[model samples]
Target: MSLRIDVAGLRPERVSVAPSPLAELGMALHALAEPGHHPGLQGWVTAVTAGLDPHLADRMCEADFLWRTTFSDLFLPCAGIPGRTALPGATLADELDLLDKLTDEQFVDCALEFICAPGYDLPSAGVVSDPELRRRAFDLAATRGPRQVRFTRRLLDDPPRVRAWLRQFLRDCDEAFFADVWARVRPPLAADARLKTDLLRRKGLAETLTSVSSAVTLDEEAARITVDKLVVGRSATGDGGLLLVPTSLGWPHLMVLHRYGWQPVLHYPVGSPEPAAPPSVEQLALRMTALSHPVRMRICRMLARSAYTTTELAQVHGVSAPEISRHLTLLKKAGLVTTRRRGRYLLHQLDVAVVARLGSDFLEGILR
Candidate 1:
């Protein structure tokens, strides 16, 4: 499945790179929820969680439904439809203020659209109107886990209370840790935005979009940006335009908020991060050696497009399954490829992050 965003009529004014405090806060909460997933933020996560009020910590646990998903629509101001002009100077307080503008019904409706649904689609959007549909939404949420159900119940049962609680929770989080972190991260985020905007001007939109993530590609002929995602959908940029938000906490993951009737917001992780210890010479050699082979290079390129099993790779490459497996083993050893079991098939995909940092690692290692 893929998301195809039509940008045939998109212009420089319509494409923007901005930093979002609400988006960062949502990511921070997700880091707190699943600290193990973000090894780079381990120290910060531990410190922040330890400093959080016990009640606030407990609230975050209950609000797992809010931050756990890629679609943290609650954090997106103006349904993510407001264009570039409105987003440049947006602060956390500015975003939070917009929340007060939502009427009780509008708030409940929006929550149901995002929270109740099993997936993002037209059918899921109407889950708010029908009792039977709402029950299905609850059943789907329950299937995800208990936390999803708990969070959904709070929103469904009493939206007004949930709204106030959510606002206060964010404020408490700002007071505890996020405010300081936001201040520290904003400069780089803005710098990244400026750099990307400049790139957009020089390279044109297609090349710029392709540069964002391995999962994203632009077909200049079709004038569409295709995103390799678990969900399949299509959207046009329209007048609302596209918002390219740069995030610090949302690393190693790209998020797209392309709901129908709203501006498509693509939240991509900024390229720069807090400096860390360089890789060892041994580690660098392993990665370089893995990519040195002609067959392995081809495999890496194929895996970049989509995940493939050994047999599938063999068929595509006109090689034996064992031969493909041997190549994959070397790539895995170098941490260049990762495998996930889907039913009986072990699907292998390129580790885009590791590959992306290869040049920088080589340069830094050589200079050192």
Candidate 2:
């Protein structure tokens, strides 16, 4: 549904982090199920998905028109999600059926009669006048244009089709992806929720909201939190407030949607993984060890001035080339340095951005 986004000024106490409900999980899973539908996703699908049915993937992708005009983001509830920290008891079928009913009655007018603002007015928002609804319709129609309005109207007229299509789409995904991948996804997703809760307790709301993901950031003057998404439309926040859901399938990105006719919710990948986790733990140790030695720090400083070769550095330090080589290896593993081979010499240069961000971004100061 035009990748709906609702804007709000959320107070510290009002903001919360939650694990996605089963229904919401279905939506995120749908986003990734069809790699063939979007060429860009093929590599991602191949890398992460095991034993995926090629035909099913294509079918799921086609169901959303390959995310061409409108998508199933409308099906998931933006407000009143049942679970606080784990998946809701609702089965996939239960979720699909509930959405079908909502779209049948609650969203019918907004889809057909209302065209401009195209705002999804939740029944929970209470009754609104026809004139205001019409105004919103016109606003939305103007933003999305006629083609999308027509497409959405057609779907509203036939809610069963969308429901059936989604039911099958999720079933196929469950077999190939979700059934296997969901367990691994659970802990990380919960950890992310806990991390935000802790951040809210420790750093307060403003900082936690800003650090939620790269895609979400706060506007200073208005206290408006803008979440970046594929589509562009401005939506007012509902009484239900903002919902922050940590996503497992949606890694390295963010999603903003108006819950069809509910509150605005932001689904984003979890940020700042726990240091105790497997590879991350080892990686952290490497970075700490690399930054600890004085000789390496001097080498980093020198490289920042200009790229240098091992022999040149060894000559300056009055050490053997092998020792400089060893130090450079450690720095590279720490992500503090990068190298480009120029004939016989491997030119080493400091990763200035990495080093600079170490003070804030990579938890280096926290590690200390």
Candidate 3:
């Protein structure tokens, strides 16, 4: 599947790279809830999880769905216009203030869109007002997973309360760990934005788009940009243009919010690229040792073809879940495997790019 963004009407001014603390905050929660997805942030995730109180941990679990679906979309730029707001440069408080301004209806409406059809064009609020249409949308969202069903029920029952909960939840997260995280990531995010801005100025938009990630490509003649994604979607930039948000936690995946009633957004990874840095001698040795086990090698081979949960792997390999999980921990620490939330389960997959890069990385390290 691929996403095609019609950039025929897009202006150079329409594209800008900027930091988003709210987005980062949401992603931080996501990283915490689904730590296995972000192997690179394992240290940070472990530290945060270990330091968290039960109340905070419970809070994070309740809001985990926000990340799985899309938290950044909920905080769309004011008026859905890209350059009209200072959101690109806004602080967490500033963004939260904007979020606070969301009326109950608007909040629920936005939530419904994401819950129903994530990664597609967001229907305008008016379109969502149709009773039958809204019911069908909610029905579709409900079928997604138990989390979606529960969230939908709560949202439909009392949007204002849910809204308040969301606000407080984010506040709790900020007080707990996100504030420090924002502080640490802000400088790098700013620098990355500036670097991309410079790249845009020196190179053309096509080159800039391609540089965003290997998954992104631009067709100058077609005046379109295509993102290789799991979801198939297509939309035009329209007059609102595109907002390019750079995030430190957005690695391993790319997000495109091509929606109606808002400017399209492309959230790309920044700061350091994948494999962030070359592996150390000890790290390479560990990786090699991880694959030395026949069972672990077979598991890697299976994951290279498709993602599977620990239970599923156990069933297939005729091993107990506990044993599979133990082996997975070793592989995860070795950076040979990574996991992401698929419905209610964590789906583990082989990090093929990392695996392929191992040989070159080892050679480069030795040569250096």
Q: By TM-score, rank the candidates, best first.
A: 1, 3, 2
Q: Please provide, for model 1 over 275-357, each residue's C-alpha lDDT reduced to its tens digit, 9 standing for 90 to 100.
A: 34445556678899999999999999999999999999999999999999999999998988999999999999999988998
Top TM-score: which candidate number? 1
> What is the lDDT of every predicted structure here?
0.75, 0.56, 0.74
Candidate 2 wrongly placed segments (more than 4 Å): 1-14, 21-44, 47-50, 53-58, 66-71, 80-94, 97-101, 105-157, 219-221, 228-232, 258-261, 271-368
Which lDDT tens digits does candidate 3 get at residues 77-160?
443533333345378777777776756655666676656753236555442345776577668876877777788778776777
Candidate 2, position 188, lDDT: 80
Error of 2 at 263 (Å): 1.0
Q: What lDDT score goes with residue 313 in model 2?
A: 93
Q: Measured by TM-score, how close is model 3 to the native structure?
A: 0.69
Q: Kindly indicate the candidate among 2 and 3 with the higher lDDT.
A: 3
Report the number of backbone clashes for model 3. Answer: 0
After best superposition, candidate 2 residue 155: deviation in angstroms? 3.3
Q: Give candidate 3's error at residue 76 in angstroms.
A: 4.1
What's the true lDDT of residue 246 in model 2?
Answer: 75
TM-score of each: 0.69, 0.51, 0.69
